[model samples]
Target: MSDWSPLHDAAIHGRLLTLRNLINQGWPVNIITADHVSPLHEACLRGHLSCANVLLSHGAQVNGMTIDWRTPLYNACINGSQECVNLLLQYGATLHPESDLASPIHEAAKRGHVKCIESLAAYGADIDYYISHLGTPLYVACKNQQLDCAKKLLQLGASVDQGKGLDSPLHVVARLFSGELVHLLMDFGANAYAKNAEGKRPVELVPLGSPLFESFLEREGPPSLMQLCRLRIRKCFGIRQHHKICGLLIPEDLKHFILHL
Candidate 1:
């Protein structure tokens, strides 16, 4: 084993003096452990901000990724360490990196780290970056029922309708019966008429006769004429029917019906 390996061990154990001494003795600050975990990743994971600073000052990669593909920034965001998150960002840490399950913003939002979310956004983190399982940061916040975090993300331009599957932030809020978040999303111009892959709108996702459903109807007002017309067209032509209209085969009859009107 290399002598420099102890620097990561010292960082994990919070032995700042030993870590500093190792650094002073020409130990590379960002040395990785056997598991591909960097000293920076370990120090940040342990909330050893001071030791993290020591590593950062000595040229440790602030955004170093572990064997599991988690960055130090991911650790800070997951642990809700606002100071550490800010420190990492200030020192050139990456807020947006393609990862396995989630992004740093998704981790921060899942845990309702408001400061971390704000910092990441201010640093040009893609507020709309979608993860595989968690969807967008907005969707994760809504799924976890983090209302304040969701609101902050919306204010920062998170797509209120963001999601991949038959889900969206508004739909998740409705499912959780989060009336406040629902109204907040609607007020921010979330597509009230937006549909998921299953063609279900946000309101349709809310349980029938639930308070959230009632509130959704009350706040957004009745569906607009265009919406009502679309529904009528769907009823008349059916959702799956296609017909020739204006010498073109209409793939979606409702679209063709509306266009004809």
Candidate 2:
């Protein structure tokens, strides 16, 4: 799916020795194809750690941009390589994208690469970074049915209700009628009654015979006390502070209760 040159071919195929030989022969580590794709992007995109290491050592542009504005870090995240993500960050790879569609964090979340998402967040990437087309990372995770990515984004304090325009994360997950996703979104403060562009609530999206349909009908009338309490507790702690529940001097069971474990 990537346009490549001879150097790109070597690095992308994990040919560490061949890559080193090419660079030794005065081939530019930063050589770009007509499309501005670098060997580093190719190496990281294929998750060839050693080849990437060689290229970086030879002064490859860590933040090199492709014609579409994709950087090596974004390519690394697309490859789902947490190590490569860390490596580029160490080399000062920018977490922000020149193009919204090229965002490393959104790409990671959309592809269900939870560790890659975590790495990006740990390096100060905006967890709730919203794009004009992709919404937030949480919404992308939800729309793709990537439950783990959605849960991790929530834990890292991504806004659950802030999705593409009127479409909340809840709105996307409800269309799938996935009970697990619905429960996770609810736990993370997604609005059950949130409306989409079509003015349809999440519950309205489910088919009648779907297991989630009657379950929603049963619970939609009144908020459960436990659910209300959970919300209140999270509100008190705010977003990221919720992750600190593990470090609190509370009973283990109480900590689990707070974490919805």
Candidate 3:
């Protein structure tokens, strides 16, 4: 944040009047600190919607990236500012970050910022967008124990088994010993016996007496009849056709059940 001008301070602090005055004096709205932190970046990072509006209206780079590759939209999602997110999107902010480390969708999922995740998905973000280090957004959500995000991703049709390489979301959840997450992923059709690069199953990663271990042990063989039925119905609909299931003439309860709502 070195070499930051008063504009940066005004934006980060939500100082609308001072921000306007600096702009009136012809201060560059797009000026950056040595770290490539722009006033617009500051405004959105702090959820200062008014300051963000002024900067964007005066030609701030909507997609301006920091030295660490963080965008204004990425910053907004990190802060869980749905208002700022909408404002940035209105000005044509790119939903996908160039760097997977700072992807807006995955970042939101990690923090359990369900509204931000919903907005990103509604705007056509790749729900299964994969990063080499972080795996898919669903894996990130599971790794962070963000149950709401994991469910939301599933509702949006994220592939349940697509984790980092062969390490599925179930692996991350089981490693954390979270039985709730384990059941959630299994219900969504995660592979229980999935082997990571080291050939470790999720069950082997947890303590023997742990609830997660018990759950994993009980999951041997094919899923129960009800689970099989659910999986079959979803398979017929497929991932792409999931959204259209709501329009099907099925019973309301059946639709909700199938959608995992």
Candidate with best TM-score? 3
**Local accuracy by lDDT, each model:** 0.75, 0.85, 0.89
Pick the lDDT winner. Answer: 3
Candidate 2, after superposition: displacement of residue 240 in Å? 3.6
Compared with the true structure, what per-residue lDDT tens digits does model 1 show for residues 1-261?
243478878988889999989888988876676666888887887778988898898898876776578999998888788788889999998777656454788888888999988888778888888767668888888888898888777655566577656677777777677888887776655666777777877889888898887877776656667656544553454312313233444456745544333
Total residue pair clashes for candidate 1:
0
Model 3 Cα shift for residue 21 (angstroms): 2.1
Residue pairs in clash, model 1: none
TM-score of each: 0.76, 0.92, 0.93
lDDT, model 2, position 237: 81
In model 3, the runs with Cα more than 4 Å from the true position are 236-243
> 89-151, model 2: which lDDT tens digit per residue?
988999996777699998998899999988888888889898989898998999999999998
User: What ranges in model 2 sit over 4 Å off?
Assistant: 1-4, 221-225
Instruction: Kindly list the per-residue Cα lDDT of model 3 for residues 1-261, writing each as its tens digit.
Output: 458899999999999999999999989998999999999999999899999999999999999999899999999999999889988998999998777668998889989999998888777788999999889999999999999989888877889999888899988888888888888889888888889988998889999887667777788888888788877888888654687888989899988788887
